[model samples]
Structure formats: structure tokens, C-alpha cells
Target: MTAPTQERYRILALDDQRETVLSLQRALRPRGFDTEPYTDAARALDALASQPDSYDAALFDVVLPDVSGIDVLRRAKRIAPDLPVVMLTGDERAKTAVQALHAGAFGYLTKSTDDVDSIAHTLAQAARQRLLQRRAAQLERSLERVYGFEHMIGQSAAMRRVFDAVTKVAESDFGVLVRGESGTGKELVARAIHERSARASGPFVALNCAALPEALVDSELFGHERGAFTGAVGAREGAFERANGGTLFLDEIGDIPPAVQLRLLRVLQEREVVRVGGGAPRPVDVRVIAATHVDLERAVSDGRFRQDLYYRLNVVHIDLPPLRDRLDDVPLLVAHFVAKHADRSGHSPPTFSPAAIEALCSYDWPGNVRELENVVQRLLALVPGDEIRPEHLPSRVVGASSGRLRAVVVPEPQPVVDDLAWTDGMPFAEARRLVQERFERAYVTRLLDQVDGNIAEAARRAGMDRSNFRRVMIRAGVTADKPRRA
Candidate 1:
């Protein structure tokens, strides 16, 4: 079994009174914290300025010989704006505390008998606040690394709202259903949520129901007991068990089979899962986050999916706009992708010429952000010059700009079961059934791809009312995400 993760708070304590500094350090140390006490304020300020990210918060006595604690607070704020700084003072004057607060101290506490508990409590609270801020920053950095904007990128007002939604939901335990078209970075949204949530320290387990075989899907989700099935060699935990106290992201959840749907619904409702062969149900504290690319409500109406599970998973819905809708962000995304690949390739970053930028903005991104990244990589590989011009881009992109390729809107259609006849003369009934299934699967997959695998939007596009789409997805053998490759 994996060890429980510990939350560590690093504190820098500065006080002219060595005894007081030692007391504070001793009090904080037992709470799973790392304390660095300094009698000299100048030394603490220097240390803070040099390595701002190293500490969670700083506690400083109001007065010091080398520098006033207020001055230290200012320096710390400059170095780390989000870092909490609390002032410790023997003075009882409210005005003094106000001044300290005005100088950017998170809180001011007098070194009085009543203030000890308050100080300790405030310190712990400050540590938590600082930790949250740090997590948000880390998430932003991760988003920038993956798809820019922490997975949701845009300068448009609509795009900004999406960004705001992500930040707002990150601090909560609510299950978020991200809806968007293919390549819209839904998985990135999931990552940001996981990183920002309390479960940030826990493992993030993802599985795409549509990608796995129907027979193996259940075993993949709720681990099979040894000897439960032909491939079961040993007892193991499923995604639900693995993500206990963490997040279980089910991508393409609209593809889950009817049998698996019942089990999933039971787990969500009961907060426990019974392994394939196990007699008893094990409690699981997983946050259920499911995504889908199919129109689940339509599937439900068509009698291909379940309806009950839909309402269970649509707690918080986040709609991710397609790349085509947020065209203004193309330049930012291009520069980000170029810089990213260049860093990996160890080559000088390529500059985009005005014409190149225009071409990118003009082309209809059928594949969305993923397609954009691939194009950027292709340009980097093919273009030798320092500047990327229109000629450096793919011919399709350039041709699309010149009206050689017209943008076509394909109406969302139900999968036709008989469309797969070219390869094998499997009986028409079976072929038609498979084709219809494949069409629904492809439709959902494309929608997921369009919205970057955000299930909510995929459902909406497929004409599934938000609540109904979720249920149909579960029954249609759809999982929220593709399972992690072993």
C-alpha cells in the first residue's frame, strides 16, 4: 500500500527576541512543519528574496534592530506576493496592527497571553492559505506547460469566463463535467482541477471507456478478484479503488456498457465498489469526474443508454469552447507551442511572420488545439529558417486560407451499423450494428477531441440535455477518459 501524503509547511520566523523565535519554532515544529528561526531580520529578508518559493509563510516580530518587521514584510511581498506574512508585536495599539496589515502583513498578533493560541492558529491558517496559492500557481505553470492558460486559453471574454470557472471550481470537491469539442483540452481542465483541489497530492487516475473492449471495461474500472476471469492472475484494485481519496476521471463515459453503467451508478450512490469476484464491497472515497463525447440524451431517447446515472454525475458542468470559437487565442497558443517544442528540440525558437500568423488564424481548426500543436511541430521540423512564413505551414492550412478548402458543418448523425462493409463480409446485421456503434463512438470521440475531451460539451453537441447525456454515456459503454497506458 502507498503511504499517506503529508502536507508540509515551511515557515521563516524572524524576531529580535531569540527566546520568542525559539518558542514559536518549537510550537510550530510539532505540527509537521519545518521552521527556520532567525534573530536577525536582515538575514531573513535576504534569504526570502533569494528563494521566495522555499517558504510557505514568514512570521516577524514588530521591531528589530537591523530592520523593522514591516520592512521585512514589504520585501517578502515583493519577492512572493502570495506568501503569507504575519507580524508579532508586544504593542497593544490597534493602529500599529492596522499599519502592519496595511503594509501587507496577512495578520498582526501581539505577543500576549491570549495571543499564543491565536498566533498558532493564525499561523496554521496562513500556512493553509499559502499552500492553496502555491497550488494555484503550480497549476498555472502546468497548464502553460501542457496547452497554455493552464489548459483553458483565451483572451476573449467568453474564454476568460471559462478560466474563471476553472479557478472557482479548483478549490472545491464538486465533480466537474467539462463540455467542449475535440482538441479543446478537456483533460487539461481535469488536471488543473485535480491540481487545485484538496486531492492534488493524490493520484489522478483516468480511463476512456470507449477505447477499451467491452469485456475488459468492468475489470479495468473495478478490479477483478483473482480467478474471477480468465485473465485474472491476482487480486487488484480498480480505478475507483486506486483513486480513493483522489479523483477518478472517466473520459468518454458515454461509451460504458449497460451492465457497467449499473455498477458505476451503484458505486457513485453508495461510495463503494465490489470487485468482480469479491463478495464484499470496499469503501472508496473517490471524487467521480466523468466526461463524454456522445449525445447521451439522444442515446437515451434511442434506447441505447441509461437515464438514471445522468443526474448523478452532472453536479458541476464546465463548458469548454472549441478552438474555432476562440480564434483570438491562436496567436498565443502558437507562440506557446512553438516555444515548447523548441525547448525540447534544443533549437533556437522560431518566430512567426505576420503572414504565418494570419494563415493560422484564418484556417478552420477541425482538430482544435491538438491539431494546432501537431501543425506547430510539423512546421518546426520542416522549416529551417528562423522565421516561419506562410510557406512553412502545412499546404492544407495555406490552401484553406486561399478558399481551396471550404469549411463544412457535418450534422451530428447516429452511427450507421452497416457502414463497415468494405473490409469484411461479416453478416449485414452484425456489420450494421457495429457500424452504428462505431458511428456513435466516433461521433462521441470526435466531440471529445473537438472539446479536447471535455464530456459535457460533447453531450450538448450530440443534443443530449445536460442531465440525460451523462446517463446515456454511462450505458453506451462510454468512459470519461482513455485509460492510462501501462
Candidate 2:
């Protein structure tokens, strides 16, 4: 088992007898345990309840003044189910031992044992087991942070294809063209590729072509000698020279001016760059990753983007699918965004209602993943409660799902059995079946309606897998017309 950190493992110990607590602390303290002894069981229970994950393991005497050890053990398990509880008592009855173990105690030991060595040994083993279990849980959480690539969360077939392409292209230094809609994380994909490449240790320089002025395009791509232009107060290295032995990501490459495009092409072909207004050519061992949302082929045909430069950057092409095409990944992406926002805001992640998730999934994300993240952040900041429901979602999202605004129209309250009339001679089993059917219909109908007929979202809210939830809907004879196909 993995041991706790090098510092003493914090153990919460409770015993009605002050002397016994003192003895326990003395015995364990010498062996690298930092024990917090409490004579009253109430205080110990309170501490555990308040900070469930703080202590590595807890020790309780089977008989206590405030409460029974069994009761404390049961409550501790409820507070922190994974917390290891070891029962220690002066009584050595087999029945007590059975009760302690049955109540989720990791181990049971008698204080009257002649071997002082055995007491410490048993406690140490239980504490180590708890530490190891906690460590494993921590590792699992860390693993959850990674999906397809660093910070790129998606499991859809479209994303898997992108991941596969990245893996193949990252091994080489050939120029790559990443084509995707705006806010589709083109730069993120480029960074993911560079991270997996041989030049991972090298710097990644990024400059957006569309964001830069036409005059600055040439100076940005290639270094400029001192006094090369009005702003050239000092000799400065451009993106190519600065990104030497690394990667240069040119975003919106289609927007690059014609003259700058030729210089970029030469840098790619000759693996070198000559500073503007300078006679000397400086060789650069930099990989080029260009991204553009515009149709480069069409641009080339229109005499806009240079055909040769387009071909050079298009050695390997990776097309990121828009969020609308990969709607199945919405739930995953929403969860990632929620957690990311919650961490930054120092707030516990609020729950997303099935209806809210449905609204998110049904809408065509024209702004893509970036837009989704922004929406989630907005909800986190504005939503009052811990649960984000359909009513809490922005009206735009609800309307976009069906291209028309839909509101939850609550019908006037009526008697639950108003629709069903039970006859005096009705059999018990038949009456029960009818009541069950009515209840199922009402429950499923309300759930489906709240989610705007998104079955997947309804199923998630019901805490069941999609298949099982679908079966439940079918069993209840409930049919829902969703805005989008799951």
C-alpha cells in the first residue's frame, strides 16, 4: 500500500477515557502519526463531518460517553464513505467485533491486548490502506482532466479523427494547415500537435493574420533590420526568427497580404528568413502550422490567397468539425466548461438540469466550443441557485433549439386522481397497475417536456443510461419529438 506523505499522517482518535486517548497518542506519535485526541465523541464526529477528507483514518473506542462507537462509525461512513475507520475497545467480545466490522470498520482491536507492538501495527496498516485508496482516487480525478489531448475535451468520432491525424502529423516537421470555423479551437489543435512533436521543448509563437494590419504582415513574418520602417527603432526578430527551432502558428493565414505570402512561402521552402531591409539571410529550423477559416482553394482561384503558399501549408490538412456536427460531445464539453469555470471562480460546480443540458445539446453552436464556454461562464456568474434549470438558461439558447421561443407552460393544479375513476368492485392488482401507469405517464411526460423532448437529457437527469431511459419511456408509452437527432 502507498504510504502517506513524509509528514506525519493526521489521525482523528476518540475515546471516552482521557488516559486511554493520551496513551493512544503517545504510542502512535512516536511512530510518525500526528494524532488529534478527543475525549468527547461528539467533537470528533463534528470534525469528521465538517472536513470529511482531512483525516487519513479515524480511531474510536467501541464504548463512548457521547455516542456508541458503532453509531459514530456509521455516521462517519455517511459523511465520508471512503474514510477508513478502525474500532478500538477494552471489551474483546466476538459480538462487538462482528458489529464493528459489519458497520464498515476497517479493523477491530482490543486495547487490553498484551502486545503493544500489535496495536500500533494494526492501526498503521489501516491508515496506510486509507492513504493508498485516497491516492488512487486522486489519480483517477487527474486522469479525468485529460480527454483527447491537453485541454481539448471531446470523444466524438469527428474529434477522434482529428486526434488520429494529429498523432500521425506530430511526428514530422512538415507544414500543416488546420481548417475550421472561428472559435473551433484551431490554435489549441496546433498547440496539441506541437506538444506531441520533437520540438515540444521549443517555443510556440502564434500571430493572427486577420488581427494584424496589412503593413505589419511582412515585418511580422520576417525579422526587420534597424530603421527598416517607421516603427523599427531597433533590429527585431520576426515570428520566424523568434520561433527558431520551434513552431510558428499563423492563424487566419488566408488573410495574409499577397507580398507577405511570398516571403512566408520562401521561408517554408528554403527553411530560412531574410530580415526586411537586411541583405543577410538567417536560416530558421522552425515548423509552420497555419490555420484559416476561409476557403483557401476558393481564395486561390479568386486570385486572393496565393496558390503556391496554400499548397505549401496544406502538406497535412486537419479539419476541425464544428460543434453542430459533433453535438454528442456537448455533454462532455459542458462538464469540462463547468468545472473549469467553477475552479477559477472558487465555487463548487453547480448542477445542470436535464432540461438545461438538452437546450445546450439541441442548439446549433454556430460559435462552436468557444461560444459554449462563454455561455457556461455567463451562467456560472448570473445563475442564482446551485442547479441550472431550463428556466435559468438564456432565452436565446431555448429559442435557437427550435428556432422559436418555448416556455414551460404549467397547467392549473388539479386532483391527482381526477382523470381516473375507480369502481367499487375493481380488483386490487388491476387498480394498482392502473395507478402505476398513470404515475409513469405523468412523470415521464413532465420530464420530457421540461427538456424540450431531448431524451438523452431526460435520461441523464433520471440518473440512468440512455438505453435504459429509452426503455422506460417506451414502457410508459411516451413519445417525444426532439428538435435535434441524438
Candidate 3:
């Protein structure tokens, strides 16, 4: 098989030895590189200052005849702050290596230990790292602007509906709740609304409620005094206070414990928050946007979630469609990801063959758009070619039946045995008691897991008394690891 055409990279190589510089040029040529060799550090600095962007990276000897390589590295950085510079040394002194790193060298390598191939690898890594940093900075700035139809890339009807809804939703300050499966970009929709809303100039804070422990949820949502709880060395502002006069995005809203939910409801109604420790109620002007994957309507009916809180947060609901339901947008999304990943990796975007695109569209992306982006990034970094073929795709995506969108995942109902089923001999009261017991066990167990085995919080959220909730927890075989707070 013929070798893959490697990406051509230009470099400025400086060394005191002319023969060492000459040998480097010949060694790197086969690796798809062209070097501008310089034995003098002054001349090398002049070249870099004259045309900074001309070189993809810089290679300098740590100890030069006239000046130190660290000086040249510093100069290169100032000229093109994005340029990656690697330092090389003949001596095995750790101090020199540390100094070079402290001076902002992309990488440091000892000449006797690292081979040509290793050096080449480090240079490539540096280039990619710098490119990724630049991409992140650009994206950060882009997010601060108003988002509209082009906020996310797609031409499918489902995506069009989402964009249109976002435009209308941004016109008002109504509380928004974005509903979608994991990886469906719920946070992206929240950000789009925040950027376009009147509070664009204000802070847009986001927190994943599911990621925090139940014990800390209170402190995170509401500020705490210096002596509020354990490890409270200093007073800290909570998400609500930090997001005052702005927007606060609460992700995984369904996971919030019942006690916190009650407090959250109060905050929404009163437009003020009382710190965890004794304190005066401070008014806040935060517009909340929540996101969730669970079927909240069912949760409300099950009494695991508060009904009044649901109505307040669900003022304007936006449901994002899974990627499989909008397969027509696969090719467009694939192209966008390719360009994005390639730019971040410092490589030209490779084209995806029709067969490859077909395979991608055929696979059911259970993880949604986020999964697709990850796969594309992997292929971009590993696939060595100008075009991505069906053979280049993962085995799972190839030959897979892109059937209908996978069913929304939910907890399965418990099996009902003959004894559990109602009979003519059983009285209505007995039958009702038996069925209610089963439900209490199942709901209590699930809620315990949701709250990270916090029985007290689960009971409070379910609006059940503590001892009563403990009795149900015992029947459900779920144990609470946390002691009840007085």
C-alpha cells in the first residue's frame, strides 16, 4: 500500500552546529516538513519577526553561541502569540528544562534521549494544542453575541422549528424549560435564549443540578454565611446571587430534592432568597431557564415532584428532537463537525464519501448530536486521507439498520404476580392497600437513588413524614447513608 500524504509543516530550526541543522532538514523532509535552518540566534529571531505566520512551529537549541534559545522563544511568542516553540538541549540538566518550560516553551526535549520521530510528534502536538486554544477563544467570544437561526447548524424541519421557537421565546422574559434526551444540546438552547434575550449584557450562569450532591444543593442554589455549615471558611455567593440581574440555567432540574424544590418555589414566587444561615432576604432579579431529560409530567403525577413548581418553571417549554428523528440533517451536521474538528486540530477538513455519509445517517445515534461530533473528531485525528470512506467508519455504524428513533428510556414497571393481583375474595380496602404499598416501595427506592440515598430529602420532596418515609424505605430495601439533620 502507498503511504498516506502527510500534512506539510514549515519550521524554523536553530542550532549552533551547521551539520546538526542540515541533518534535521533531511530527516524531517520524509516526514512532510520543510525547515529554515539557522546557526545564529539573532538571524533566526529576525526571520521570525519578519514573517511570523510563515512557520507552523519553531525549534531552537537551548544554549546558542551568541544568545540563549529562551530569548528567541520569547521573541517568537511576542511576534505570533499562537506560534508553538519547542526547546532542544544537548545537556541533561533538569534546571535548564524547567527554565525553558517556565519561559513558555511549547515543549522541552533532551537531544540524547529523544529521537527524530519523538521530536516530530511533540511539534505536531504543540501545533494542535495552540490551534485548539485559538478555537476555544473564538467560540467564547461568539457565545456572547445574539443567537438566531444560525445558532446551530441544521436544515431539517425539526431543527427549523427549534430555531423559530427560540426566536419567539427570546422576545419575552418568561421562564423557559428545555426538555430533551441527554446529548441533545439542552444547554445550547438555554444559551441561545439567554444571548438573544434582553439580559444578554448580564451574566449567563449554568449549573448541572444532577452533578451536585443533595447536601450541597442548598448551598449551591442559595448563598451561605461563613459559619453556615462544615467547611464554610468564608461567605460565598450562590448561583442565584451570582446570577442576579442576569440568567441562571439549572440543568437536570428533575434531580433537585423536594426540600430544595420547595425553597426554589419560594424564590421564584417571592423574587428573593434567604441565605442558608440566618440572614435577611435579599431580592434577586434572575431569570431562570431549566433543562431536564426526565418525564416531569409523570413525576408530578407520581408526587415525586411538586405540582406548583412544575407550573412555574414550565411557563415556556421547548422540546429538542433527537438526531435520529432528523436524519435529513446528518450530512449537514457531519460537514460542520468536520470543519470544526479539523480547524481545532490544525488540519484541512477531509471530505466524507457518500457511502460513509450513508452509514453515518443509517446508525441510530443513541447519544444524539454530541456522539456524532465525537465520532467525527476521532476520524479527523486518526483517518489518514483526503476522503473518508465507508471502510473508515466504525464497525457499529456500518451495516447497522438505522431503524426508527430508539424508544425513550424509562424505568420498567414491576412484574405483578398472582398474589399481587386483585381477586374477587379480596376486599376493596385490602386491594387498595396492597397496590399502594407496592407503589410506595418502588417510588421511594427510585427517589432515594435520585437524591443519592438521602432518605430525609427524598421524604421531604415526596411530602411524606420522616418516620413514615423511613418505614417505606425499609420495605423498599433502600438505605440512607446520611444522618438526618436536626
Give the candidate order by descending TM-score.
3, 2, 1
Over 199-313, each residue of candidate 3 has an lDDT whose tens digit, in order, gives: 9999999999999999999999998999999999988899999999999999999999999999999999999999888699999999999999999999999999999999999
Considering summed lDDT, which 10 consecutive residues are worst modelled in model 2? Answer: 405-414
- Using lDDT as the yardstick, the better of models 2 and 3 is 2
lDDT, candidates in the order shown: 0.74, 0.79, 0.79
For candidate 1, the lDDT comes to 0.74
Worst 10 residues of 3 by lDDT: 403-412
Off by over 4 Å in 2: 1-146, 403-486
lDDT of 2 at 482: 63
lDDT of 1 by residue, 324-388 (tens): 78765777677567655653443455677655666777788989989999998888777786788
Tens-place lDDT per residue, model 2, 316-403, is: 9999999989876776677667655553442345767655776787788889999999998988887776788878777878877654
Q: State the displacement of the C-alpha of residue 24, model 1, in Å, after optimal TM-score superposition.
A: 54
Count clashing pairs, candidate 1: 44
Question: Which predicted model would earn the best TM-score?
Answer: 3
